[model samples]
Target: MNAENPQSPPVASVPLYQLKAEFFKTLGHPVRIRVLELLSTRDHAVAEMLPEVGVEPANLSQQLAVLRRAKLVHARREGSTVVYTLASAEVADLLRVARSIIGSLITDQAGLLADLRAADRG
Candidate 1:
């Protein structure tokens, strides 16, 4: 039931998979991923991240805003600086898993490349 219009039909709910995809889409940016990786270790003030992220201040701010909107990170103001922290410990776990997956893929590719080179010589 719509609060504004009692007779109006309820809005369609987003599918769980669709929501998941949207969440991943939010993490697709390199800057956002770096930000998350940084927060994974410990909370950091915006100034602390600027040098590590190596992006213009405005660009980093935009990435932080995206992470904030996705609920992957939380921000708080401390005097003159805004500090950020991961919303859940699971986010750090997720990054570790992703790193492992990518590492495995790279290792597999390297093995295949070595096999191909050996075959060429043989």
Candidate 2:
């Protein structure tokens, strides 16, 4: 926005990579990741998630707020309970892709370990 022009459209101050880095940083927490993974399966109420997430109520609420700010999840009121769901199906896909990548890496590591064991035996 120009100082002289009061009605000018907003310009992006942050670079794309910086924005992406911030987004990944939002996912950097273990509790946040667990909450996202749970939301990936289905919409969960705060009460329901309390047990599953294995965190104190205040901690879970804080984690949920971080996810909400990141726009990775949506929250709605169902009576007195707050229900949360993934903001996009792509989030679940991202989780699945991450699992596949980690699985492959672990498989490769296991193969290397087996080879080492065989060499040691010989």
lDDT by residue for model 2 (29-88), tens: 999989989988899999999999899999999999999988999999988989999999
* Every model's TM-score: 0.91, 0.90
RMSD of 2: 2.4
lDDT score of model 1?
Answer: 0.95
| lDDT of prediction 2 | 0.93
The C-alpha stretches of model 2 lying farther than 4 A from their native spots are 2-9
Poorly placed runs, candidate 1 (over 4 Å): 2-11
Q: What is the C-alpha lDDT of each candidate?
A: 0.95, 0.93
| CA error at residue 52 for candidate 1, angstroms | 0.3
